[model samples]
Target: MKTPPDRSGITFEVGAQLEARDRHKNWYTATIEKIDYDKERVLIHYRQWSRRHNEWFQWSSPYLRPLERVSLRRQGLNAPMFVSGSKVMACWTDCRFYPAKILRVNKDDSYTVRFFDGVVRTVKSTKLKPVDEVRT
Candidate 1:
């Protein structure tokens, strides 16, 4: 049996939920299977139900962010600015702002947003802006 590696500031523990960037810079969730301290990366097993052969695929991490469990941080001075299910605008990598809904509030104060087109993305609070709904 192999011993689990010591936890580092950037390295996550086994079974920790996280999101990592793909080749196209899209983020996807995965679980930490192993940690490589020497290489400063982690082995993540991402589940893909669409795949037939490789249902749980492993990927290395340096581009991974630990999933947040708390909604607010910073000692009550920095509570999350937005709540889940809130309508907001999110900034994409292309620098364009698109309408999205906050799916969840992360411990890091970021949010998982779903765009109008059904694309989901985890973005920082700074990249979000409140939207004023216009009743029809």
Candidate 2:
């Protein structure tokens, strides 16, 4: 697996959701308003549906920070590749399906990806072979 690149010139689609952790280590979901990969952080716009207040209030998460990217080496030659915003299927060891977008392609052979539900994760290319070679 390879480490992901410094996330610059990367943009998330509107309405995209992202996962963020607070100082308390509590995880929450927020919508992406803007991104700054060079800074390794993103501005997340969040709102909570308050049943008690019967209204939605605007909120923001602290700059969502990313950890260092890592990579894994594969035995075979490189296969066809996909670009940012390309929709692809990711299979994890847990036998679950994660639909994600390519966020950054690292020099070390890892990909920083954003899942459909808006969680940013780094996956090794060795672990994530493309399901289809044909580009959509």
Candidate 3:
């Protein structure tokens, strides 16, 4: 199979779905509502669903994952594959998944990861999920 291209050349436009890392290392799937290339930032709108309340939220960030990296439109309907150094969402104790980069593969098959907020942790493979599923 062919490999995906680097995301360095990819550009964002209005209505593009992107995964963005927040200051707390949490990642959320959002749609680009506005782009400000001069400031290297974009405004994103996302939905928040809760038992008590459900609403649409807007946020802006500089760190974003490319559509190619976060999209689930692949050859099959199976889970997306990930490797060391891959960007993923790791489940936290608060029952939330945060944005993190897989640092290393442990002997037991677990992974050491560094969150975008500068926190590091070791987590089981099951506790990890793809950024693509953040929306669905």
The candidate that wins on lDDT is 1
- Mind giving the per-residue lDDT tens digits that candidate 3 earns over 1-136? 2322335624556776766665577776666666655555556665352323212222232456655533434323334356788989998889799999998876554678998898999987779987775474
| lDDT ranking, high to low | 1, 3, 2
For model 3, the local distance difference test gives 0.63
As for TM-score, the candidate ahead, 1 or 2, is 1
lDDT of 1 by residue, 24-69 (tens): 7766666666666555555666646233321222223356655443
Cα-based lDDT for every prediction: 0.67, 0.52, 0.63
Model 3, position 49: C-alpha lDDT score: 27
TM-score of 1: 0.42
TM-score of each: 0.42, 0.35, 0.38
Model 2 residue 58 CA deviation in Å: 69
Pairwise TM-score winner, candidates 1 and 3:
1
Worst 10 residues of 2 by lDDT: 66-75
